[model samples]
Target: MAGRGDIGVRIGLSAVIFVLDGPGLSVLTTHAQEVAPGLPFGPFDPTRHRTFELALRAFVTAQTGFRLGFVEQLYTFGDAGRDTPRAAPAGDPARQVSVGYLALTRDALAPPSADARWRPVESFFPWEARRAGRLPLIDEFLAPRLRAWADAEPGERRRRRVEALFALEDDAGWNEAAVLDRYELLYEAGLVAEAARDRPEPPAADDAPLLGQPMESDHRRILATGLGRLRSKLRYRPVLFDLAPETFTLSQLQAAAEAVSGLRLHKQNFRRGVERTGLVAPLGRTTTGTGGRPAELFTARLGAPEDGHAPGLALPALR
Candidate 1:
């Protein structure tokens, strides 16, 4: 029996969580008044603003003093009571729904303004570690509980869920783009602290630290949405260019792909694939100072198709 006023208006606000490569996959984040001192909150106001996109542009510029580029919608989260309690204004019945977005930009830009940082994404979602080889944490911690859930069901449905989540059929493999699904599954099973509700006492600290560090609020979840989108979109779009340097060696490009995808890629095969996609062309430049070998420089092809007009370079299979 909700009235017209009871129903919250659909408000859109864009957020970008950039993945910066250094030692690992890092997320660029900002601290607003809620998370940091001496920060204004009015910049995020959706009302009296024409579009969330414009608001986002102003928000980032105000907070970090850097203009963002190559942006896209990440996800929309509208779960009731999801915002921090302390920040909710009195009599503000409207649910604070946030429309998350992701963007890829050059890392050469200066560090974001104070209270913002680029923290390793693994710091928040360690279960995403497919970098080394096998996911031992998954096999040890999540598998037991997941199997139990599957066991509760009777047949194909159970098998399908198990196979999809664990990537078990024929030893198939893990897919990194299922970030949101994986988090939701973990939440449903009470594997993450955020999933806990109506409990008299908080659950004990998880012994398995496979999942990354939890963010201040649902920022981590929003980040997962962005990561999933970027991982999938890069396969069919040339958006990877946004994150690349103006000129890069093939190895550098490969490394960027590997960092974003969270998987190892074959060197020769990856280069061949990139060349075949017509996404990059040689810049008639070569550098021999990369230590032991000479490397040719290349740049991403200009005027590449946007919104899936042209096929993107095929990424090497994840190992």
Candidate 2:
């Protein structure tokens, strides 16, 4: 008989591959017919793969046909109920744990398989992207519902949390790095589909407010975790190069940053910030077909310096 320590624990691997697709940050996804799309995921077979990262890379490449670069381990999601429709197949161990990884690329390739796709990141959390000035869903649907949820609590805890995470009230400010926090809060308040998926009685359509499109199982939550981590890391690291082409104009670089953060950055201020970091050098090449004026091309420095300075300028305070 197997001992307690010998219980089979299924090891799964998932990848949240971020690409700077046209006008936005996109994620590589796979669909299991009739179910929501999810990150490229597969089981980790120790016999076939030497390491967790290698296993994840293999699975994602097999699913999306796009090789990943600049990969990093994001987090481990082992919650008991996280394995949804894709729960271990018959005769497999009942226990499961998934190791999540983050990968960045400059291009979103056409999927080799019919079920794979490159989806816009904002589709999973529409409220996170601010490119369209202001999203009506947040103002007309999310705010009122969140306020009601906060007020229902007898103590000040939930209310304060709502204010902090969503930047409610006059003085509170939005924190771009709070992506996961905001998503989890919405889930707790029963405003997202995943929360309803787990509940015995799902909320009415009016109550759930179609928070973007849902992913299969808890994959959306894992994507949120990756986004939050990447947002926070951008402040201290020169990791954005992983998502940039070998050569690009300053305007192009700034646009990439804006797309990832979902905020418009002041052109002059952003350029100044980039200059101060000394992270890019002239490539001695220029593009003349911009239709306005010739633009100089630049390449990212070989290494990201850690000088204890806040990266790029923070968004101008929101009014």
True-vs-predicted CA distance for residue 75, candidate 1, Å: 2.7
Those runs of model 1 whose alpha carbons end farther than 4 Å from true positions after fitting are: 1-14, 32-47, 85-91, 108-112, 152-159, 197-210, 304-308
lDDT of 2 by residue, 122-239 (tens): 8898888765555577777888888888898899899888878876665656687889999999999888888888888876567345587888878998999999888777777777
The TM-scores of all predictions, comma-separated, are 0.84, 0.91
Highest lDDT scorer: 2
Q: List the pairs of residues colliding in candidate 2.
A: none
- Best candidate per TM-score, number? 2
Residue 289 lDDT, candidate 1, scale 0-100: 59
Task: Candidate 1: give its CA RMSD in angstroms.
Answer: 3.8
Model 2 RMSD in Å is: 2.7
Superposition error at 125 for model 2 (Å): 0.7
Question: Please, what is the whole-model Cα lDDT of each candidate in the order they appear?
Answer: 0.68, 0.80
